[model samples]
Target: MSTILFHEIVFGPIHSRRLGVSLGMNLLPYDGKLCSFDCIYCECGFNKDFRTKTKLPDRENVRAALEDKLLSLRREGITPDVITFAGNGEPTMHPEFKGIIDDTIELRNRYFPDAKISVLTNGMHLNKPEVFEALQKIENPIVKLDSALDKTVRLLDRPNAPGYSVAKQVERYKRFKGDFILQTMFVRGRFEGKEIDNTTEEEISAWLELVRALNPREVMIYTIDRETPAKELEKVPVGDLQKIAARVEGLGIQTNVAG
Candidate 1:
């Protein structure tokens, strides 16, 4: 029952454990959450609890607000390391996501040319040509792949699409051609009385196979850092995360651990 929501279209220059000084861009509604996957560990809380009247912010408003914030920061002699697309929910769900990305890049060039643009997505929309193309344009396109097993993925991510499968998602990620960063959240817990732990030997073995296949620029291994909707879930320790990273690094893929 712990729920947290970002209340503005443009919020935060918060220090990200992985991405560093990031200014967030929320394409979803400011008052509610809208996402393709209802993840068990989502800090924003369950989608059912966040129903609201507010609509997704349009491209124009997002551009204006972001520019204003960047200009103000510039005046104060501050520049974020990254302009991140993350907030209440899935950012690519926006109708004009590609165009908004275009606008963001333009603004970044005009203001903070050295800053990187990153999108923290679930990778469900990569099937769409536009979404895929827009993602390719960004500096850091971090996509999620919680587990390689279909059953474990369902238990962990709870993607809204019943037809969502790990094989299909892995294939979609393949389309990126090693240009994206793969972000996996490792957690152990029970949902509805069934025990769930994606950090097990079987799960990690299957997941490492997919990681090797993808050959991403980098692999980000992390655990829950805040209150989750599913209260039974537990964070993986830094030592364990380092072990996981070592295994991943053995595959010749660089890994970053956020524990």
Candidate 2:
């Protein structure tokens, strides 16, 4: 049941396995996790286990805090490669997400214009006009799509929305029009007794079809790298990840593997 939670509005210039020198922004409450999906491999743990009593950080507070952090980094002669929106939960869930992203862009231009702005979202909120517009403005909008099958999505992601489905998710991602990055987590495990693995032949074949249809700017295939709330989960090997990357590369799309 090990989990990691960010306690500050803007924390870290931590080295990311994929995005280098990332300065993270947490729009969710500092006290707990808030997400649309309760992923089995989430490092933030189960939502029920980390409920928050505090409110989400307001737009002004987030702007001020991020500006201060950017100023401090400038003073230290450190330039982040990316200012990432990956906090306690789904960043797009924040009511003021659009405004915060606008502020982040402004601050990044003023401090480190070379740095990219990225938001790691579950892609559930894309239907929201504000979320969609905000994501479109960012340099890296990494959307998660764990499986091409509705059953696997239900078993793995445990999305809170009753109407959530693989078809709808694909449609939501299609709105990006090849502008977004598709991120998938490959894992093998048993949750509550059912076997779960997205690396199977059937899984990959179906997933590949969707990949071809989407034709994203890049495909990011990764496995669990931290202690997950569901102890039964196991990481997919780096070699396997590279093999999968090869299949994606065959489509003439850029791919990155972080196992």
Candidate 3:
């Protein structure tokens, strides 16, 4: 089985396909993966594979580690383009998520005022008032909307909530009021005995309606770029992604294809 990708609390001034040179903040436990979605294409592999006894890093530890990293980068004259909250799991699920976001904002202001603060989330916790407020504070609230159909979402994202539905998530996403960046991962695959593909015309048409309703500032359409826990999946090519982007752009919503 594929394993968790990041092992440290504060990791990477790595090049991100979407966020540019980013410094990552991992609020989840370093030894395990804790997430709301069990995406077939997750780079961190399957959630069940990396369950651990390690605890989630506290707000104080996250703040201190981030500050230390920022100070070190400053001393070395290295400036990152963004401070990203993405690691082994759903970052907003952190118990003190709002406080952590506040701490991150303060650190960003002190160390790299020009750097954008971004949170890459699966959009599960947006129903919570505090999560919504915290996401609003970030420069890039890149929320996921992999599929518009509830059946497709169940197959593609495999959300942890027993009663999770696409309609409810769309309503939660509307709370952003065009302030958030909409991210979609297009792929084709088979999980268990079922075939899965979200790049179909029917799927894209339904998705376009949701994009229209949400009116996001930007739409990021991309495909699988790394080894996934599910070995049967196939990546959507750049040409196809560009074609999808064109269709989305036709709706008057700016779209970027990460290929």
Cα-based TM-score, every candidate: 0.98, 0.99, 0.98
Between 1 and 3, whose lDDT is larger? 1
Per residue, candidate 3 scores C-alpha lDDT tens digits across 141-252 of: 9999999999998888999999899889888988888999999999998989899999999999999999999999999999998888998999888999999999889989
Candidate 1 weakest ten by summed lDDT: 1-10
Show model 2 residue runs off by greater than 4 Å: none
Candidate 2 overall lDDT versus native: 0.95
Q: Backbone clash tally for model 3?
A: 0
Q: Where in model 3 is the C-alpha error above 4 Å?
A: none
Please write out the lDDT profile of model 2 over residues 77-180, one tens digit for every residue. 99999999999999999999999899999988888999999999999999999999999999999999899998999999999999999899899999999999
Task: Give candidate 1's TM-score.
Answer: 0.98
Task: Return the clash pairs for model 3, or none.
Answer: none
| Residue 7 displacement (Å), model 2 | 0.1
- In candidate 1, stretches whose alpha carbon ends up further than 4 angstroms from where it belongs are none
Judging by TM-score against the true structure, name the best candidate: 2
Quote model 3's TM-score: 0.98
Q: Give lDDT tens digits, candidate 1, residues 144-258.
A: 9999998888888889997899899999999889989999999988888989898899989999999999999899999999999998999999898899899999999999999
Clashing pairs in 1: none
